[model samples]
Target: MESGQGLGELIPPLADSDYYLDHYDDLSCIITQGLSGKIIVNGQPYEEEMLALNNISLAELSNLINYMNSQWYPDKIEVNLNTIKAQLANCAD
Candidate 1:
C-alpha cells in the first residue's frame, strides 16, 4: 500500500474512499480490460498502465471483485457475477 507516500508516482490506493468512490463503477472494466493513460485519484494524477487479467475465468474474477469490495469497501458496494459479466461485456477490449 505504501509505495511513495506523497513523493513521486503512486498506485491509486484502493482502500481510500476518495479513490474507490470515484472509480468503483468502472473498476470492473478496468480490471478486465486494463487501464492506460492518466487517471486522477483524490486530485493526484497516476499514469500507471494496469495489465488486464483476461487469463482468469469470469467466476474467478467475480470472486476477486466481490472479495475486494467486501474487504476494502465493506457494505458500501457489492459486485456479483452478473454485474461483473455486464461490466466485462461493455468493456472496451
Candidate 2:
C-alpha cells in the first residue's frame, strides 16, 4: 500500500472477505471487491492480504453507481465549461 502502487496490485483475494470489509469505506470496499471478482473470474491469482482492505457487496455497488451518476453529470459540465474558459483566456492573451 505504498504511494503510487497500482490499484490491481493492492486488491486482496476472494477468500479474505472479512478482512477487506473491515478496513475500507463502503464505496471503496465495493469497488475493490468488484475488481477482485473480476480478477477471480478471469482466473488470476487473487492476493490474500489485499482482501483485508475492502468488502463491498453487489447491492452496494448498484447504489454507489446510481449515486455517482447523479453527482457526475453536473460536475462534468462544470469542468468542461471551466476548461473552455481557461483555454479562451489563454488564447486572448
Q: Each candidate's TM vs. the true structure?
A: 0.77, 0.25
Each candidate: RMSD: 3.1, 16.1
Cα lDDT tens digits, model 1, 1-93, are 433133356566666547667766676777777888998877888988878876888788878777777767677666678887787777666
**Global CA lDDT computed for model 1:** 0.71
> What TM-score number comes out for model 1?
0.77
Tens-place lDDT per residue, model 2, 1-93, is 233223564553333234333422343433443333433413444544434323544445445434443443233222233332343344311
Clashes of each: 0, 5
| Candidate with maximal TM-score | 1
User: Which 10-residue window in model 2 sums to the lowest lDDT?
Assistant: 72-81
What TM-score does candidate 2 get on C-alpha atoms? 0.25
